[model samples]
Structure formats: structure tokens, C-alpha cells
Target chain A: MLAVDMAGETVRAMNGSMVAYDGEMTFKRQGMTGGEGLRGALRRRVAGESMTLMEVTGQGTVYFASEATEVTLVELAGDTLLVESDSLLALDGRLQTGVQFIGLRGMGTGQGLATTKVEGQGTVAILSDGPAIALEVAPGTPLCVDPHAYVAHRGQLQQDVVTDVNWRTVLGQGSGESVQFRYQGHGLVYVQPAERGGILEI
Target chain B: MTSTTFNAATLPANDNVNPYAFSVDLNGQWFTQKGKMIAYYGQIRFQALSAGPLDMLVAESFHSPLYAHDWIVAEGQGKLLLADRGFDINSYDLDKGNLTIRAANLLAFEPGLELKQSIIPGFLTLIGTGRFVAASNGPVHFVEPPIRVDPQALLGWADCPSPCHHYDHGYVRGVLGAARMMFGVGGTSGEEHQFDFTGEGTVLIQSSEHVTSSDAMLRELEGQIGMLGVPGLRQLHGTIAQRLAAEQQH
Candidate 1:
């Protein structure tokens, strides 16, 4: 499930039920435009998932800590780097966090994992298969993130909840709507093309 | 966890205390109704022998809504192998500064531990596992237990019934009052929304003021379970009558 589209960096199936993600990978997040029709374009979305397009950028590759136990995102931001972990041994992207209101259970019980944030910043690296998109999130804008597939964001204006949405009859409608991550600040949030969590690893 | 400056209120003005929870200076804003754009860093940790199928520690919030930052979530679940979507309850990017989110553990859709981007603004998340799907700003927005009683629908028990009002009690006094009086709760926010979920199944909720999390409110609400024991549980006469009179004064 871990794929890398970057040069030199590779996604290989290693010995034992593990995958080896070596080399550098390229990845980026796309935003939701053309409000009319938008279904998550990530190829690996689950059947009943509510995926949305993102307006952020990301890059990285997948690494294995041990067998199917976990996956790691090795990515870079400017001169900084990020290394994140995931529960799905099979996921490919420059990871981060976003709307998990629908996929909360997937990330729980370690079923699906993506990232962990520590205070401050550090040199983090990620591996993924992508054509990295570099977007600028200014002070008045912010982005929402999924913990699964993201790298990092600098800053943005934002709000913590999309707590209210009338039930929609659309694809990923009211069943479990996204809590709005309103971006009104001067920061960029990292997002992925796919909705990548919510399956039971076991 | 973010860095929090704690000047020991219990200790001394110059002293600092960093237990799990501590107070921060709000610049006169923390105690007021208006919210000042602020940043706070802190962590909540519990030493327990049990792990996995983990549960959130339900705690009463000490800071007023005005004093707390708009966003507060479990930045990380610590040094154990957390399940995908590592459990979370967060609220961030309070652009409107209107709503406070709460909930009893919502699951992550990203099954693998990876970073994710949200469609909503002013939000970003990190998953212990890349397993993520969707998350709520406040999982406790809805009544813990949806009032299924037919009479409420019939009696206009829901003041606004706009569906939005049902989520947060900050709006719609009649609806909020009815919900709290009926369920004996206003709502759950912060860590209070997290419950001891042994398995997978949604727990009902109700939002409110005095009682945010229903663990206590429900206990006090035990006074009404007897009504269910009687016939036509859906119909309320005496209990609703008395509680309504009491709530109006508050």
C-alpha cells in the first residue's frame, strides 16, 4: 500500500511481511475546487469513505519499523524534515493529519495511524510517490489535516470546528460531516489526495 | 503537547507548577466572554498499567471558555503503539469563536499512521496511524442520548429543532433548557466528551452549561429512570413540569 513516485527513492516489498521504502519520494496535496463535483481522488480510498480534496502541499516516502505493525513518513519542509508513523503497513504519502470525524475509529486501536506532532520543529523526512505541489498558506488562510497523510504546514488562520452542517444527500454528506478547519490565519495546513484511514489492520 | 508557562498560583508568583493541568495568564481575556487569539501548549498524561482499546480520561475543565485557546487536541498519544487515528478530541481555528467542540472518542479514518489534510480551514492533524476518515470539532455536539421520545417531537421539546441547535446548547435557550432539563445535561466539551468506550457503539449525548459531561449529569438524571419504568415513558407530565419551572429561573 505504500507507494513512492519520487526518483531514487523506491517502494519495495521486502522479505517477511514487510515493505521497504527507500530513496526520496515526491508528493503534494490538492485543494477542492469546482464545488460542483468533487470526490476524493486518492486511488486508495475505502469504499464508504467521505473523502475531500485538500488545498495544501506534501511529500515523503513510506518506511517500515517492523512487519505490518507500522509505517513511517520521511519528508522534508524547506530545510526542515519530518518523520511520522502510521498503523496501516500499507499507505503511501508525505503524511499528516486532517478530518477523521468519519475515520476516527480507523485511527483508534491503532487501526490506522499517520503522524505525531512534537513541540517546536525538527529535521523530519518522509517518503511518498508524488508530484509535490507547493502552495503558500498566508496569514489569512489555513488548512485542515488528516493525521494519516501529511507532512507539515507553516501557519494559517483557522477555526477548529465545522461542527454544524445540515445533513447532505451528497456522496460524503451528513452521515459524518467534517468539522470545519476554517483557515483564516496566515498558515498552511498539509493535506493528501486520498482519504487513507479507517480499516481494521487485523 | 505545547509549551505552557505556569507561574505557580498555588506556589508563588515566581514559582511555577506543571502538573497535567495548570493556569495561564489570559491578558484579561481568559476570564472574559471575548476570546483573544492566543497560543497555549500543554499535555495530559496518565500512568496506567492497561493500554490499547484506550479510553480518554474524562476531566472537568478548569479554565473558562474565554480563557482557553480555540484549539486543544491530543497532539500525541505518547510512547505506546496507538491504534490508527490515535484517539483525539480537538477544537481549533475558532475563527468565529462561537462554538466549543466536545465528544466521546471519535475514530480516525486513516488506518495507517500518516499525516492528513482536512477540507475544513484552520485545522491540521497527525495520526498515530495513517488510519483516518473524518473528525468532529466537538464530538459532543449532539445530545449524548438523542431524545427519541415521540412527545418531544410532538411537544416541540426541541426549541429550535433546526438540527444545529441540537448540537451546541450555546444557542437556543428553550431548546438548550429543555435538553438539559430533560437529559439533566447541557453538553460535553474538551476531554469530558471522551467516555469509557469498551467497544464500538455510539453513546447518546446532550450539551449544556452546569453539566458538560453527562457522567455526573446522568447520575443525577437517575431520578428519571423510574419514569421509564412506568407506562408511556415517552409522555412526561410531572418531571418535565417541575424541571421546566426550575430551569426557567436559571
Candidate 2:
């Protein structure tokens, strides 16, 4: 659960995620805008990366929670944060929510081919199955992350699918972790301790 | 509370990054269960136990053929992170000692420890030395027995004899008690049956009783059923039917 103290500012949160509030507050559905106008809404529908948000405006303090999932807040300073739609919980109303094509790497992980893009300045709350660990990806030290455990990534980084497939894979003796997200460059990647069940479980 | 970040240079070597995740400083090889690895930093390669070059290592340390498909060998150098369904991750060290643990809870074990199928179905025994990681639904509690534990809460036991099933059917004594037992009248306390442990050594139990379903255990049970003849199967069928009926009544 997260408590936000608002003197009079507004915050965009996941729809129906407000648990309780004190003082005065008004929640209005973000509607078709999808935080990127009609074009963004259409792109979301086509990409299957839609996220429903509600605008909460008013005063005092408000508590927000969703399914009791662990929440971690990421503050952005005119940079981009790419996250899964479902892992997005709440964000500052000023932050721009958009969509970006991440190619077919998300196909095997079952997270889809596009990712939710949060840019501009503000704090963004992302949900994870457990506490999220932030790993730094540098030029020399690249990181290999299981796609199922990936939550989000920020900064200038190159993401690619690394496959270690061999004859053993065809013999039903493949290492369960045959595909991983290889991240290089300079950035931070967030990963939960738990791996979500994916098509690769078989 | 999300400010702390770790790079390859700072990540702990063979320690936990958090209570729910473990970081193994991989220099050579480690045996891990399928789908337990979450992430890693540096150069590492994963291959099935049946992979060509690992045959000697697999034959030396891994003795459970039933679980061969579910096991893999992680080789190379790096920090390997592992977790299981967000369970509380913990590492146990055994120096020339043996420990038997529930199959589903055993996440990853080092190659130095020899793995074998326990005589008790659904459990695996690790002999020799080295370290292994396990997960529990909650924090694990260690208790010495001379005690009876709910089977669902049992995680593992070290230096102890295998437990036997103890059914305290004391309620079915008098005529009314017999009627209750026979007709399922008063219902059960759900605590009558437990794994009774004796002698020395420590028994590990989780704080919660939610047991993660083990496919390996189910397969083990299926294998044991082959030993039963037609008459035994018939008796087992009757018992399962009664259980189903009793479950539906609830």
C-alpha cells in the first residue's frame, strides 16, 4: 500500500486502485485518451498493450493499492522508462504514458510485442511479484536476465534476445532457460525475484 | 526504499540479494532445478544434465534419474540469481553431512553435493559436502523431534531418521465416536494424521502449511503404484472414492 500526500495536485493511477482517502479527492476515468490521445489508444489496441488509468485530483492524503502486489516507485527526470502494462501501478499525472514497439523478443516471454513507455518527469510506481532488484548494465558488464523476471528498464541500453539452443533442445533435454534478455550499454534493469510462468515452462 | 542498486562489481558473491532471491558466484558449475534461475551477471552457460560434456559430472553427483529432466547444469563464471515463486529463499550448508528435503522446495544445489532419491517418496537426499538453496512458503523453523509435524509444513530434516505416518484416530472409540467416524458425522479436526519423527537431528518446518505441489512427487507416487497388484489397486480405488465423496460433502 502507498500513501500519497497531495496538497492540491493530481496523480494518474491505475483505474480502481484507490483504496482509501482523507480530506477531499475526485477520481475521473482517463478515458479514451490513454494518456497519449486517440492515436495512442488506437496503437494500444493494435499492440495489445492497453492500460486503464484514472485521474485523481484533490487534497489531503490518499492510499492506493492493487492486489497487494509489491510496489516500487521510479522517479524519472526527462528520461524514458519501458515497463509492462500490467506491472504499471500509478504515475505522476505529468508523466507521459505512451507505447513503443520492442520487437518480437516479448513473444516468447508472453509479455507481447510492445511495451508501455513512461517518459517526462515524475514518479512511476511499478508492481512486481516480490521486491524488485535494480541491476546496473554497463558497457563492459552486460546483464543476462530471464524474460519472466524482467519488470522494466531505463537509460540508454541495448536489449536483445540471447538463445542458447542446441541439439539438446530438440531432444526435449533443453535447459529450461534457453532464452534470456541480454542487456548492454548504460542503464538499470528492474527484475523481481520470482519468474512468471511462460510458454517455456514446458 | 527502492534506491539501492547493484552492479556486477558490487553484487554479493554467493549470497542473497534479498530474502526471496539468492546470488551464486558461479566459477565452475552448479546443478539447478529447471526454471529456478531469474537473472545473472557476467558470462554463464546453461545446459541440460544430459548434455554431452556434463555426462561425467551428472553421473558422479546426480543419482536421481526420475528428476533428470528437471535438472540442469549452469556453467561458467558470474553471479547467478535464483528464486522460486517468490518464496522465502534460504541456503543451507552441509559439510560431509546428509539432508533430505521435499522435492518441490529444493531450488538449486552445488555439484559438490551428491544428489540421490530418498527411500521416502517425494523427497531427495543430498550427501557429501557443499551448499544448497531451498525455499519455504515462509521462514523456516528448526525443531528437534520426538515430535509430530503436519506433512504439509515439513520442509526437510537433517541427520534424522525418516518419519512415519501417525494417525491419531482416537475419536473412533465409543459407539457415538464410531458412528461419527464411519458416517463422517462430526467431521475431522484435520490434525489427526501427522509425520511422526523420532530420535535425534533437526526437522525443518515452514511457518505456513501451504505446500507447493510437486510434479516429481506425483510421478514418484505413480511409479510406486506400479508395484501394487490388482487387489491393492482395487483397495486404493475404494479409498480414493471415499475421499472424493467426503471432499464433496464439504
Candidate 3:
């Protein structure tokens, strides 16, 4: 659970995520486009990265939690954070949310063809099935991760879907580690310890 | 609580990042169960146990032919992270000692250790001096022998002889009890049987009684099914159908 001290400032949070609060507060459901006007709404609908955010303004403190999952707070300054829509919990109202094409990495994970990109300066809280580990990606040090365990990533990193097909896989005795997402360049990748089963195999 | 961000330089070398994750300082090779790897930094290559290049290494360290398909060899240099379904993960170090763990609970181990299939149907034994990681439904409790543990809660035992099945025959010896056992009419307490261990070694049990799905058990049973003749196979099918019908009625 995350508690935030509010002083009349508004924050964007996942709809129906508020668990408890003290003092006076008001929550207003965000529009279909996430307050990005008609054009942004159209893009979100087209890209299938739909997010239902609510504007919360209050005086004392407000608590937010979803499904008792662990929450990680990330501070961003003029950088882009690419996260799954279902994993996003809450973020500063000043941050911009948009859809970005993420290629075929989402093919097997059932997360759609695009991911939610959060940009600007503020703190964002993301949820994971378990505690998420942040791994560094640097020059000549590429990171390979299972698609079902990937949570989010930030910075200038190039990602490619790496498929390792061998004769055993063709013969119906495939090892379960055939597909992975390879990340290179400079960035940080967040992965949960457990895989989101049913969406992807291996 | 203030959260710390970790990079490749900051991540631990052959230790746990947290209770749910373990990081291996992979400079050489490690045997990891398939799909347990969450992420890794640096260069690491995962090959199936059946891969030809790993034949020599598999022959030397791994001895479980029944579960060869469920394991893979991770080779190269980097920090490899492993976890299992978000279960509580802990690393154990064995120094010239042997430890037998439930096959589902065993996650990954260094190449220095030799792995063999335990006498128990769903357990594996590790020998030599190296660190291996295992997952449990909750924090593991180590207790001395002369204890009876529910089979579902049994994680593994170290340096101990295999346990024997103990059943409460007194509770199921009469005519009514025999009828309940045969037709599944009356409900048993589900605790009529347990694994009784009595020795001078440590027996490990998880706090929670939840057992992970056992795919290896199915494979083992399939392997043994080949021993039956055509008539025996037909009889087995009839029994399975009757059991399924009973289960659905409940």
C-alpha cells in the first residue's frame, strides 16, 4: 500500500484503486482520452493501450493499492518509461501518457502491439506480482529477459525479440526457454520474479 | 522506505537480491530449471540439456534422466537472476555434504555440485560444495528427525535416509472405513497419511502446505505405464474412468 500526502494538488491514479484516505478528498474519473483531448483518445483506442485514470485531489493523505501487489516508485526526469498498461498503478498528473509501438515483443504476452509510455518529470508507481528487480543495461552488456516476467523499462534501450529454435523444439521436446526479449544500449529493465502465466509459454 | 535502484555494477554477484529473487555470478556454467530465469545482465546463453554441446557436462554433473528435459545449462559471464512463481526463494550452501530437495522446489545450482535423482519419486539430491537455490511456499523450517510431516508440506531432507509412508490404519480398518476408501463416500480428514522421518539429520518443511503443480510426476508415471500389458492397460483405464466420474460428482 502507498500513502501520499496531498495538499490540494491533483494526481492521476488507476480507477478504483483508492483503498483508504484521511481528511477531505475528491476523485473525478478521467475522460476516455486520459485528458489528452480527442486526438490522444483516438490513438489510445487504435493502439489498444487503454488506461482508465482518475484525478484525485485532497488535503490530508490518500492510500492506493491494487490486488495487494508490490509497488515500486520510479522517478523520471525527461525520460520515457515503457510499461504494460495493466502494471501501471499511479503517477504524477504532470507526466504524459501515450501509446508507443513496441514491435512483436507483445505477441505472446497478450499485452497488445503497443505499450504505455510515461514521460516528463514526476514519480510513477508500478505494480508487479512480486518485488521487481531493476537490472542495468549498458554498452556491450545486453540483458535477456523472459517476456512473461518483464514489467517495465526506461531510457534509450533497443529491444529485440530473440527466438532460439533448435531441433528439439521441432521434435515436440522443446525446452521452455526458447523465447526471450534482448535489451541493449543504456537503460534499466524491471522484471518480476514470477512469470505471468497463461499469456506466454517459456 | 526508500527504494534503491540497481544496475549491473550494483547487483550482487552470487547472492539474493531479495527473498523472492536470487542472483548468480555466472562466470562459467550453472544448471537452471527451465523458465525460472527472470532476467540477466551481461552475456548468458541457455541451452537445453539435450543439446549436443552440453552432452559432456550433463553426463558429468547431472544424473536424472527422468527430468533431463526440464533442466537447461546456462553458460557465459553475467549476473543471472532466477525465481519460481514468486515463491520465497532461499540459497543453501553444501560443503561436501548431500541435500535432497523436492524436485519442484529446486531452482538452480552451481556447476560444482552434482545432481542425482533421489530415491523418492519427486525429489532430487545434490552433492559437493556449492550454492544452490530453492523455492518454498513460505519460509522453510528445519527440524530434527523423529517427526511426521504432511506430505504436501515436505520440502526436502538433508543428510537423512528417505522417509517412509505412515498411514493411520486404525482409522480405516473397519467395514465403514473400507467402504469410504473404496467409493469415496465419506470424507477422510486428508491427514490419514504422512511421511515419518526418524534419523539424525535435518528435515525441511515449508510453513504452508501448498505444493506446486507436479509435472514431473506425470512424466514418471507415463514412463512406468509401458510395463503394463494390454489387459492391464484396459483395467487401468476402467479404474481411471470410475475415479473421474466420482470426482466430477463431488
Q: Quick one: best DockQ, which candidate?
A: 2
What TM-score number comes out for model 2?
0.94
True contacts kept of each: 0.00, 0.84, 0.70
Which prediction has the highest TM-score against the true structure? 3
CAPRI classification of candidate 3:
medium
Residue A1 miss distance in model 2 (angstroms)? 1.2
> Which portions of model 2 miss their true places by more than 4 Å?
A200-202, B171-186, B229-250
Instruction: Give the TM-score of each candidate.
Output: 0.22, 0.94, 0.95
Q: What Cα-based lDDT does every candidate model obtain?
A: 0.27, 0.91, 0.89
In the range B1-250, model 3's lDDT, one tens digit per residue, is 2256677778888888988998888899999998899888777888888888888999889998998888888998888889888899999999999999999999999888999988778899999999999999999999999999999999999988899999898657898888977766676788898999987999999999899987999887887789998998999999999889978997
Clashes of 1: 170
Give the DockQ (2 decimals) of all models: 0.01, 0.82, 0.69
Better of 1 and 3 by lDDT: 3
List candidate 3 segments past 4 Å from native: B229-231, B248-250
Clashing pairs in 3: none
lDDT of 1 by residue, A171-196 (tens): 22222212223334554343322234
Estimate, for each residue in B1-250, the C-alpha lDDT of model 2 and write its tens digit.
Answer: 4657998878888788999999999999999998888899988999898888998999899999899988899999999999898999999999999999998899999999999999888889999999999999999999999999998999999998999999876775778778877776776788877999999999999999998886887788887899999999999999999899989998
* lDDT over C-alpha atoms for residue B21 of model 2: 91
